[model samples]
Target: MSKAKKVIFVIVEGPTDEDALSSVLKQIFSSAEVHFHVIHGDITTEDAITANNAKSYVAKRIAAEMKKYAYKESDILQIVHLIDTDGAFIPDNLVKTRTEKGIQYFEDHIETGEVKYIQERNQKKSSVVASLCSTGKMKSSIPYSIYYFSRNMEHVLHNVATELTDDQKVELADAFADRYEENPMDFVAFIESEEVAVPGGYTQTWTFIREGTNSLNRHSNLRILFEQENLKSTD
Candidate 1:
């Protein structure tokens, strides 16, 4: 008889994170042995998004499932979580506390919880990237990945879309430099070198789990993590 497949549970912050990261993982690891199990904590409904309720809505839902399932600590399961370090000035003790709480919440539902957090520190680059998308620049032909632009430049490429006057281009470059207090080249290098939150960092945790548990290495490559199978019901 075929052996029972081991399951790994991964929890992430949102859906966009799921799409960008999960797609790459499935493509790279499907050849490896073992199946992946994923649980999405994203709130896809418009009502949830409009009410600014995704984080809490997803969190509560995950907690409920864990309560219903009697998962134990000895099972070969993995739990991964992504957290943004907003400018809350949260105390170190509180950070530890919340992190432990998150782990326990999963352990209570599934066996063997492995929780990891990717925090944000470089505020300027993050703000610029976020604003570009929210302000509708992405729709006009700006692909979101920083790799698309000059990776070595420090400025924000000033208008990613549309032809600009020479003077306007120079002004935009200067504004980006002034805002970040760094040369465009240096800024680009820093961003590229940093450990970024993967495009679908949260959603692809299941892909990571499947490959990691079956293989000898545990590298969290964005390209490899996004391609895993779609999430399955945690019921």
Candidate 2:
């Protein structure tokens, strides 16, 4: 008899994130089942204003999807939320600096020491993570994990792009076209390397991705879920 495939649900902001994560997770888990659900498209602007709104939005959507599939919470092995920081800061928060490139924003947490650039227009008074954590709804949801991009997905890609030369850029572009088919492991290694300079928080974004799997264990929320579900790489 064959073992059952564990179901993992991922909720993201947009299609790009869905695509990117689908590719990455395909490389990470060989036998488990993974699904991506996008929320921003179906949600109203008013429903997305605060962290509670975002959580409610995601919760409703998750419930609907679950019903559509006739699957209960027990059927899912894990639920992951991925969102962008978007440069939202508290009032009178002056822990940022302006440079020729852009505005560098820093987190108040001394241990994190994260810094990332936020374009003036992209900066806001509230962030997605802040809102989600505000009501403690998402955090309290068991078997759930949350990950964030510093500014946005493009910003994360920019960090990787800046580290490569023209030739390397071309090679990377080609690799992406094929979804890094030739050497996905090397691509993963390059992104997680300390040599890659991801400003605005050192390796904050990379650390989020590399958690668990023995590379970096800074935040192991996702890692713990993977282990609990017994997800493993075919390679």
Candidate 3:
């Protein structure tokens, strides 16, 4: 008998984000055999951002958790995207330095699979957008203000509770189109793409060049490793 095929683990920022992406991916890859695992780090921002030591500790812990699910070289599609909101006392130089270190670390640990790091300067609002679009809404029901719209959405979803059906939820999403006049799916994709592009932005606009360098090195290693594997299968 053959071993059951392993699913690709696609880690995201948080549980809600995981759920949102999971829903989409499940629909898109329903017929495909790969499974997507979203890991929400157990540590809080306060614990992960206190100092260099804290950050390292959190990263190591997260890495250990991931190691538990490591698959055969040919079976795992390791894709991890971390969205960070640790903006307090963010110095320009710190971000750069961290990026460099992150890159170097990945270069050293390429065997561990691919990992994506996204340190968003403005993740709060971006996350709100991602979460809201996950809900299906109507055109007229969406509020005008992005802030107000998101808050109102939370309120409605909470009120509806289990009564919300997939079709009904999508109907609510129509309201977002009317209110923002932008495609809901497009909005979700836009925010997700932004989260993925955080490393590049760090190089161009961030302060800590060394950190940025580290992150880049790490990102490059992972990007290449995972994509190469994926290409082999697809090609």
Candidate 4:
């Protein structure tokens, strides 16, 4: 058997994100080695990371990972980042208020005791997402693309809108991965279906999601990658 030609590094926010999608992606991109790196946190909303520096921060993270493995630029085929669109694109007026000192995310609006904080977060995160998705290449000179599960991974994949405990997340993720590991094409078909799959090409799809409550809904543009890769193969 031929070895995969290059590395397809995938950065995800949590272990469950990896567990839910890695096997399916690996099967799809069989020509390249798919490696998942769980960040355990959202890079777009990290401390001191604004839209202005988000691109550079991501480049740095990728560089650090590459250096850790001593993988040169030539070894990397591309970078695929998977993130959750927690309705950050919505306007500040949509950020509702609550008495509790915590944040609650819903499909249409976010409820938080600190409304101003949430607005600030949305501003920063939205900008970061916009910057990263502006083009198909990162500042590191490597091919890059990002996809999101609205609300969150669990909301999209498992159909559970409410937040899940860590234990519940692990269980659902394992079950999801197991279901698709045998027939990744089935998972592909599901991902490409009209229900959750947003219509349009790469850049166009991003624009569609930024409108109104769409970002909070269960939508994905992941099928664009498959179409792009298929075109590459034919070329």
Each model's total of backbone clashes: 21, 5, 45, 0
* Local distance difference test scores for all models: 0.30, 0.47, 0.32, 0.83
TM-score of model 3 (CA atoms): 0.33
lDDT computed for candidate 2: 0.47
Better of 1 and 4 by lDDT: 4
How far out, in Å, is residue 87 in model 4?
A: 1.1
Residues 1-235 of candidate 3 have per-residue lDDT tens digits of 2225433444344444443345544443333333444445423243234323433443454356446655433443333333322221222333333323322112112111112222342232233323332322212221111111111121222222122445665565444334333343453343334222222332222222123223222111111222233323521
Please tell me which model should have the higher TM-score, number 3 or number 4. 4
TM for every model, in the order presented, reads 0.26, 0.56, 0.33, 0.92
Clashes of 4: 0
Residue pairs of candidate 4 with colliding backbone atoms? none
The alpha-carbon lDDT assigned to residue 187 of candidate 3 equals 38
Model 4 per-residue lDDT tens digits across residues 1-235: 2224677889999988988888888877777778788888999999978778888888888888877877778677778898898888888999999998888878788899999988998888888999899857765467899988887888778778887789999999999999999899898888899877888888888998889988788888877777775324421
Pick out the ten consecutive residues of candidate 1 with the lowest summed lDDT: 146-155
What TM-score, to 2 decimals, does candidate 1 have?
A: 0.26
Candidate 2's residue-wise lDDT over 12-89, tens digit each? 776655655576665566465677887654231233355446666667778898777766665666677765543333
Per-residue lDDT of 99 in model 2: 37
Question: What residue pairs clash in candidate 2, if any at all?
Answer: 51-131, 114-201, 115-200, 115-201, 116-200
